[model samples]
Target chain A: MTTPIRENTASESPRAELELATRDALGALRHVAACLARRSHELLGLSCLPGPAGQGRLLVAVADDGRLERLLAELRALPEVCGAQLSRAAGAALVPAAPVAA
Target chain B: MTRTTGARLIADSLVRHGIKAVAGIPGGANLPLFDAISQTPTRIVLARHEQGAGFIAQGMARVTGQAQVCLATSGPGVMNLLTAIADAKADSVPLVCLAGQVPRALMGTDAFQEVDVYGLTIPIAKHNVLARRAADLPRIMEEAFAIAVSGRPGPVVVDVPRDVQTEEFDFTSWPAPRLGSGPAESPGTPGPADLAFAASLLARCERPVLYCGGGARGAGAEIAVLAELLDAPVVTTLMGLGLLPPGHPRLAGMIGMHGAPAANHLLTRCDMLVAVGARFDDRATGDAKRFCPGASVIHIDIDPSEHGKNRAAHVPLAGDAVRTLGALIPLVPARARPAWTAIRASLGLAHPYALPGLDDPKSPYGVLAAAAEILGPEAVVATDVGQNQMRAAQAWPCHAPGKFLTSGGLGTMGFGLPAAIGAALADPSQPVACVTGDGGLLMNVQELATLAELGLPVKILLMDNGVLGLVRQQQALFVGGRYTASTFAARPDFVALAASFGIAAIDLEPCRDARAALAAVLAAPGPALARIPVDPDAHVYPMVPPGAANHEMILEKRHDHAHS
Candidate 1:
């Protein structure tokens, strides 16, 4: 089986999380989803929660393909997003000594 | 406090923003918005198709350097406009698309003309918004215009539900009308440190090239000055054409797949590639790994995502091109590079871009040259896709930035006719030229009726090859000479077609003096069409193969197939 590119926690496959600080703008969640959907196979999981004073937080779990820097830049470019951060490692790293797929 | 309907507020907002005219078609959900616009002084140019409407608005926006508006209703209207919106975003044209949605309750109930416009436009548009409440109309309308012309200019979509359009709300004083949110307010405004880093890099390199794109359109003078100061040659992308004048001493010409051989070869030898607002697109840089292989890049663009997306840069100065170039110019010392000049001259002589039969008025290049001479340097030309577009790009004497309009990023066919109409409508003083081919003209032939109705001074030059010339050429070269599905079995009588659309027609095939006939048609005050029969076997010269490097070009006439 193929190893995970970026897995911060214990998981069966490749996964990385991004925590987005956003404000409650119209269709703000859809903007994030749209950005992820444009890339081939990026979105694995996503969740949004409302915070104080119209502020909100979005947790996105993705299959990091070493393009997360550009992906984060795209996300942060949105007007609705106040900030975007990769809660996982800085860059995608290969899982250590995993079994090869036959 | 006064009260006004959401539609009236949107219309008033348009008027307040100084929008003189809008282009669109009326539909079920957008009737109220259209009616509100009718009540105001903003004139509506009705188009046959919503796609035509979008392109018309795009033409105006491109010419005026402002955010022009286009309207479309739900479902099919929105779907039709998606191409233009995507085109605007790709080329960074400032446009505001106001699309109507079904009433709030009927949105997800599978109503007659309802689709998820918000979801559909999200990926294509630079910014997307949905008006769920009437009270949000003022803020939404204001932000739409601001966002469109802000930073790197691009299209913005605002999806208005029918109920939201008709719902009345208390009106506070309007927000200040805005053209942009300020170039410095956006992300990637370079600091002093970044400018210093970029300047030092440029000052050190002996063979420097300033590669520009559409984002640097507003800073042509600065680019010219920067090139002179650094003793560098300036190379532009397709979108960045016409930024420098025709015979500017530093202009190395356009770069990419179909670019000039001198410009393409120059990239391989440059010691430094200072990309000004250029994105290093695949078309501009073939085989990215091999592009500018010997050079260290200093990329300056407003978008941070483009910094390391394609080719890695040694110095990434993320900011507005005008400000960054201005800041960097003063720091670099002026010097003469005779060695680099000699190298550039030799490369140009070795691989000159040859347009044979240019002396004849009937050929593609000759027709474009004759038309350009009669129309003058002030005229704006819009080209359709494929061979016609490439021909116009290579031959059209583009005098300024916005004068040369083409669907560069999307390469969409059927963009020429309506865009020429829009350009004429935007500025009546300058003549507009629409250079198109048989296949592209047929794609949007319906707009000919619209052109007749408006009676604008648009000259449509038809290069009739009876087939898709570019596709046929590629099929001949790469696909082993099988010209399948590229040829048109029965071509329409274009001269008669123009007459049927209530426009003047001229065919250069039998004309004794084709140049005089063309000059007469282009000089006429109203709409006209000229059909020039082109040889189907004619191929655009010096094409770089799909996966090959810029230097590896397939020359013209090398693979000629003698078959009908």
Candidate 2:
């Protein structure tokens, strides 16, 4: 099981939630964070959970949706990011951790 | 059976992979690799800095469309290479970067010159590996080449430890390499259904435009055939500059920010946009939602990952441009949209790009146009970033693919000189020209010594504006003209500087006829720098202000400081 890296209360402006599954390499997490900051995403919270086959997952939230489309495309295109998607539930905590393969 | 050190395996791999040369500087951690390389027939060009080494390798890869190698030591050496690595990633250049690290045991121990290179390169490289054992060298090296050149071509980092370099294992049998047929392309031709679907769209559209990018370089001939079939105009991104000759009748000029006015206007009006190998970068698409609101898009790219990432594709053709274009051409019906073609052509006159001092040969744009004429369309041109790069993009006539090399995605400065050297080395027969500015030239001026040593025929066309022209222009237009810290208070005598590096130099500022001086610079030199002094306030027109749409460009007539 894992916990959210951070979380924030709702603001006046629109917000979005993002989750990413990626390869567990050095600086992989930092790359995603930097990209998010560059696109001006608010980055409300982030959480890392161990994934299948030594992979890693991150849950993120942003304050603005103006540049989210391009931001998502860029995030998905990152070499380390294996998967990126929008969360169906707004402002949700880290998705329930999946059971690690025995 | 024979046993050999990991160092020997690396050198042997280069030979097996057909890499003829490498560029880098030597350091303590990398001394063993250099020593091993010395035994091989591969020639090494020593660069004064690691950044120059990486750009030199990029130059080779850009020209040959093959993976080239650059070497560096650990810690600071690897740090210096980060910019070039990121630049390659942005532009899709194929490069294999080999860096030396402290021994595996000393990793994470904060030993002397020990840096976490693997972490530093993760964000910038296509793929990277930290070689933990000597036995892994052969497979890792082979995989490095395969990954760098395959898929969307990009740089790969292989960090080898000092102790791993000396370790040896015996018994001769090596793992077989996974050699594919060619670089990443379609698994097979598009299916009959998909080809028919694309053909139907082409047949129906009246105002169709073919948008090409660097990925479409190999499919130029096929693109011409398809354009003729549809009577469509071709517009290219910065990377796709030479896919169509500058003089081609169907060429509609470049699109996006700082692009030709007619091209940007046509992009908005086109009913159907056949996007080939372009990902619709923000610079090209302006505002993604409204980019081509009325057009139906048919995006064709070799990489499946690029499809529908930025712009939705009505018909996404996932394959190599050549194969996909070839298959679809047979199904396309022949027709000519003469009316649409004439409309776009007339738009050029309607929105003419004004050159304030074009009649003066010493002007930045004028000098570039004059040089392009003197060198003919065959000369390979590389440009450093800022106003000079934009001017060259607008003025220089690129006749073929790989002829115009610039840092398009990353917009890197200090790339021109070393890349020009690499191009000259790749093809000694071709004339290489590097267009740079005073600010950019100073960034990698050390490579002037390297150029003198090789004595390669590379002409450096320096536009001396005495300030960061692009930044100043932006400040003038956007920031109330404060102009803080953009101007160089003290400047170098470029001619004397070049002479000190053993290169001939020419100053066009005082010449009665600048054209004659430029011609001489091109003709009489193994390596020379021609300085053309330009007005600091002169601006490149037809610019799309930051955060504006592509079509909403500020024309020359609109600017109060048009000729300043």
User: Worst ten-residue run, lDDT, model 2 chain B?
Assistant: B177-186
Native interface contact recovery, all models: 0.23, 0.05
Tens-place lDDT per residue, model 2, B478-563, is: 77777889999998999999999999998998999888888888998599999989788878777888778788888765765444
Per-residue lDDT tens digits for candidate 1, residues B1-564, read 779999999999899888988999889889899999999999898988888999999999999999999999998998899999999999989899999999999989989989999888888898888898888889889889988988778899999988999999998986753332222227445778877877787777888899999888888999999999888899999999998989998898889888888999999889889898889888889988778888878888887788787877877877888877787888888988889998999999988887767778899999999999889899999999999998888888888999998999998899999889889989977779999999998988888988999899999999999999999988878888898999999999999999999999999989999999999999988999999999998888778888889988777755455232
Residue B562 local lDDT, model 2 = 47
DockQ of 1: 0.17
lDDT of 2 at B348: 79
My TM-score estimates for the predictions, one after another, are 0.93, 0.87
Please list the residue runs of candidate 2 whose C-alpha ends up more than 4 Å from where it truly belongs after superposition: A1-102, B171-192, B354-360, B561-564
The top-ranked prediction according to TM-score is: 1
> Against the true structure, candidate 2 has what lDDT?
0.82
lDDT string for model 2 (A5-102, tens) is 11233444466667776665334577777777555567777777777687777777776555565566556655456667765355566555553222
